[model samples]
Target: MDWLGLLAFGDTGWGDELLYGLGITLGLSLATFPIAILLSFLIHWAKASKHRPVRIAAHAYTTVFKTLPEILTLLILYYQSQAVVNWLTGWIVPGSSLSVSPFLAGLIALSLVISAYGSEVVRAALNAIGKGQTEAAQSLGLSPFNTFRKVILPQLWRHAIPGFGNLWVILLKDTSLVSIIALSDLVHVATLAINTTREPFFFYLVIGAIYIVLVVLSTRLQKTLEQRASKGITRMEVSDA
Candidate 1:
């Protein structure tokens, strides 16, 4: 099909739904990224806690999540949510049905998965800081909290950005797994288009194109962030108290 035919909105084509799905995918990924990053930072702090119990708890969380299969985690959430929604509404909500809403289920699942990996990235980034830096800050009389906020966080972010960026792209792609939940996301839409039109190649190719564009643009943006993060070194000037 020609460019016009490829994009036309009708039984013949799916230009409009594709564009809308693209927006949903981008919005979902970006929205969840911040949540994942915040959760990751907290987990990182928990992992780095001075108290042995806190540290052990944090260690167990990351270890457990990292070992989980993604589908199993999501399925557990999906079924639990299904029960809750039906109980609250007094109507068996369709999430437990053969067709669930892919969007929210996928979001919850991918966020959990990304947060798992993101926490590790964050912990490593913070650990990469020379221990002497914090001690030097303490010697100069900055409080523990202030030291982390001013001296440690700035440097830690620079190191974590690259890893976070890569993970963001991966999570964005992982959004496709939501199809099992039945949301009409891009992949689900493509499946519909292919099944109905009997043109698997055409729809699949279109899906690939959309995903490639998103990943490439994201990769380029991350490269810019990587450059910015690398250029300035955070050095704390501490004088003996």
Candidate 2:
């Protein structure tokens, strides 16, 4: 087996296709993360809301998503979401065709699934900050929004980092599920390469290594951010002392 030629960067090998797939995988994960985090925060707030309906809805959202297998959720979103969109488009635009791309469907599915767990992470972090901090901020005449933006969020990251970091790694690996929908992400491309070259072990090993490298890199970045967030807290404490 001419390994070098097989893994070459151009049209001669699977390298370019693999790289393209890697790009898609990374892009999908990156795009999904912020949306997930935002939804997590929103859901957390809803869970804590005074309104009974809001809390029930938020609880149901978390319960359903967390209970469902991620792959099943992805499959449902990929097909059913398109059906919903088609129905809406048919009603609104008459003859126009509308469909959800695999990427979009994957994003929505991953975001919902991850956010269900992430909401709890957010709730925990907020609880760790305690009601005292909010009371203190309010006593100082800080508006609710300003109190959260200026006081709570800065410290929230300190507590939330580890949980969010774990979620990020989970999200990264979950990106592989998109391949099942023919998204042509890293795993899908690797499968394609294996089909043509008749080298399953080699392609799967390559993708595994790629995913491991990404996870390692993400872990290091998370550590760096954690240190930075903690340092800010340390400085504040020292100043108070």
Candidate 3:
């Protein structure tokens, strides 16, 4: 079959399978990003905590995740988490069997890895916002949470958008790693198609194009967000002049 025929949208072609795989890839990334952001905030808060132990623990978490290869993290989580889950299940219930799905394993592994880097991004953004804003809010009788929500958060995104945008692109590409664990992501689907059709170059090139397209779209969205985040500041500065 020609390349066009191979990619046709029907059972006779691998188009449907590839499209399904693309959905999984996108789904995994979208699910993992929010979890990573939440973890990043917690980790950043821990790092800034007054307690030494909390800071130390957060440091260790980031160090271990950042140092390890993402693929190794995925492998360990895929296999070891099942063992841990089974042990807990057996202890809780006399007879129970539980297994970790590749999707869950990948989600957790990717979240941890991304959050390690993301925490640093959060810290930097918070630092950029400066303590003066918080103090000013406090002077106005705003609660700490209210200060963060109203005063700090509005400015935080302007600084963080670029760093987190880069991480999002990285996370999108990293979704391909889950294919190794048989998660049936885009890359995995391409691999399966290649194996069946013996057209390695063509299938791999197609997936590469797909990844490039995703990255391009993500970058454009990031720029739009950055512009929106800066809009108020730009107007304020102009008014000051």
Q: Estimate each model's TM-score.
A: 0.84, 0.97, 0.98
Task: Give the alpha carbon lDDT tens digit for every residue of 99-212 in model 1.
Answer: 335567777777778888999898788778879889999999999999989999888888898899989999888777766677667887788777866778877888898899
Q: After superposition, how far is residue 153 of candidate 1 from its true place, in Å?
A: 1.3
- Candidate 3 per-residue lDDT, tens place, 90-206, comes to 999969979999999999999999999999999999999899999999999999999999999889999999999999999999999999999999999999999999999999999
Mind sharing the TM-score for model 1?
Answer: 0.84
- Ranked by TM-score, the better of candidates 1 and 2 is 2
Which residue runs does candidate 1 get wrong by more than 4 Å? Answer: 1-4, 10-12, 50-53, 85-102, 234-241
Candidate 3, TM-score vs. the true structure? 0.98
Clashes by residue pair, model 1: 102-183
Worst 10 residues of 1 by lDDT: 232-241
Q: Mind giving the per-residue lDDT tens digits that candidate 2 earns over 90-176?
A: 899997769799999999999999999999999999999999999999999999999999999988999999999999999999999
* Candidate ranking (TM-score, best to worst): 3, 2, 1
Q: How many residue pairs clash in each candidate?
A: 1, 0, 0
Local error of candidate 1 at residue 30 (angstroms): 0.7
Q: What are the root-mean-square deviations of the candidates from the true structure over C-alphas? A: 4.8, 1.3, 0.8
| 10 residues in a row with least lDDT, candidate 2 | 2-11
